[model samples]
Target: MYRVWNFINNYSLLLVAGALIALIWANFDTHAYHHFVEYPLWFNDWIGGDFTRWANNYGEGFEKFEVGDVTKVLSVHYLVNDILMAFFFAIAAKEVWEAVILKEGSLRGKKAATPLIATLGGMLGPIAIYVGLAALMGSATFDAISRGWAIPSATDIAFAYLVGRVVFGAGHPAVRFLLLLAIADDAAGLIILAIFYPSGDLAPAWLLVSLGSAVGVFVLFNWLPRMMDRGDQLRPMSSWVRKYLSFWPYLLAGCASWFGFQEAGLHPALGLLPIVPTIPHADRAFGIFSEAEQYLTDLLNQIEHMLKHPVEVVLFFFGLLNAGVEFSSIGTPTWLVLAGLMIGKPLGVTIFGWIAARPLGLGLPSGMRALDLVVVGCVAAIGFTVSLFIASVAFDGNVVLNGIHVQDAAKMGALFSFAAAAVSIVVGKLLRVEKQHG
Candidate 1:
């Protein structure tokens, strides 16, 4: 019973279950799925009022100010994709910051160069393959589908980590390498999202305001601690006061940044990212779950621990919201994404890794062979959560582009990551990459 509970609690399992439920539910009753997602939630008598009219009236203040005017007509889907997923991206940002900046981390200094290069290949390869295929179809199709070039560029860290554990065991060097690559991939994906995907005309003033808020939080959280250490009399406070009060600035700044991004026509999931590296973090010497006193001092670590389970739940809902697609809706863009992820990912990883190791003089980690790189590449092909998010952004509601059809197809392609997982398992078994038990 305990084992079953643990298995169910596992992150990968939870994500898989959520995706499975969505797939089944969507396929079983497509109408029900659509209706459930589109069900309106608002606080007013005008439940099904014209949205554009409401927006215009609210903006111009012609109608009386009321919180009830705000409505989420497609409540469930948007809530999960737009709001809940922000925390997921925040967590990813935190992980990337820790890997690159922490002293005892794997990706710090010269050691990071190899994995960073590999990540570049991992990104470029998919774009090349996807764009090349799209180009062959015709100029119009190519231009439209090219927006999703980054869709296959992400490797879901949890899924890839699980597959790595099974293939290379718990303590293998390959696992660490894969982890670093995934982190770098995430960093790249975030950049792509910010640069390529904007909701409306970019508002520089709002972006500046967001940056200012992040800076303010950094000053409060980081500078305040330094001041206390210097024995500044004005900054004197009890330990408990300092510990608890420090969290508020982060919350405030995060809210400001989210709003700012919304106003700036950018994806708000990236709002907390610039703030993560600024938050105080403990050295890696204090193990991830350590109860050591220093662990309590690290606000970023504390926030991450606090949000872990919540983020997991959000990811489950994320899968449920985004993974639903009809088989009949799939087309060329879907096949292109599948090919990009499944074939291009592994090929790019292997080829680029060789370039880095051989000519670039960055040697492979100890106990890792060339063929092991191939297996790791296969694992890297498992792109799910972030891929789907990119898909949503890429095809969202542009009428001239057959946006609805393309969006459904892109989503189907993202869900097809299960095929990549199966391929990884097969490759791992063929290579005899088994867990070593003492």
Candidate 2:
């Protein structure tokens, strides 16, 4: 029991494991598991699994945020992405800036395949999965949400790190590269989201305004140090001007940028493109303000960290909450989606990686084999967060209202994908372990 606790805690893999457990409990009833499973978390009739019921309840119960005739209660999904996921993107931006741009050799330091190859592999994985699913399902259902192309593009660093720790022990460099690759891949995913997932209703006027705001933010970031230097030379009546002007105004402006992009109907996550530049460096000394501004920066950092995980957690729960697959519902389509993730993902990612590597003359990392590539590909298929978000945006609940429920169908496909990936990892590990012994 202690060992199990340790495994869950150390790996951070508990999120996924817990999600799978919740999904199974929701869908199935073992006496013990059912007794242990908590229902309160998912008990809201107004917001539970039934979309039509939730919609009906909203019309009857509330009267707020009425846009024309579309008066519905706020979607948790919308709240999570628009408000919560903006912070997720902010944190991700910080990490990517640190890893790829600021940190030395963080991404470029590796002797293995170029950052370009890994980034491409990250992209090609999902596209392959989608195309294969479309072909197998005899419909373009998967392609409807081109927004979801990035869903399979990002790997969960925590899960990948846990696997690394378990198989290779702590402080392994290979794991570090794997984590870095995942981070770069996530940044790439963010770029794709900003570019692809717009609602297609363009106000060229607002887009120009957003672009201007972005330019202003960039100019502010560049001009800040010069402004501070000038302020120092002027030796203001109140020294606080340097700090207050430097910190709080920028923070407010940065937050306003979040509001701006959100209003522009782009994914709010794109807001980070402007604000990240405005944040003061931790290493920089802000000598003027009353230490409050410094504290605020720290606070912002902490908030940023906390916000990053919830978007992920919400998706994890949504996956679990909806993963309640009726075993009786199992059929050819089920198997096809399952096979797409299990067989299609690794196959696509590895082949793409291999193609990107050989003739391009980008060699694989030392001690990294085709099998390791396969396992990495499997890990890539664990698309809980982005996949669901994409499904919501792409289908806009149209698929759910249509005969097939969108959330349920996505969860089913994701669960099968996750299961296949998990099995692949376990098998890959066992094979590696056996080879070491032999």
Candidate 1, residues 1-438, lDDT tens digits: the string is 001112113556778788888888888987676656544445343223335533432333324434444542224555666666888888778777777777876678777777778888888888888888999989888877888888988888777876776778767778778878988998889999999998556886888878998888777667766766576555454244356776777777887887788678788777777777777777762322223422455677778767767877887887777777777767877888888898889888988988887899998887787788888888998888789889988874331244446877887888887687788878988988855432
Q: What is the C-alpha RMSD of each candidate to the true structure, in Å?
A: 5.4, 8.1
TM, every model: 0.86, 0.69
Assess candidate 1 and give its lDDT.
0.73
C-alpha local distance difference test of each model: 0.73, 0.50
295-409 per-residue lDDT for model 2 (tens digits): 5444334344444345556445444443454444444434434454466556766776677557666767655565566666665655555554554444443443235544445
The total of clashing pairs for model 1 equals 0
Leading candidate by lDDT: 1
- Once superposed on the true structure, which residue ranges of model 2 sit more than 4 Å away at CA? 1-75, 103-105, 109-115, 139-150, 217-222, 230-251, 282-340, 356-358, 400-402, 433-438
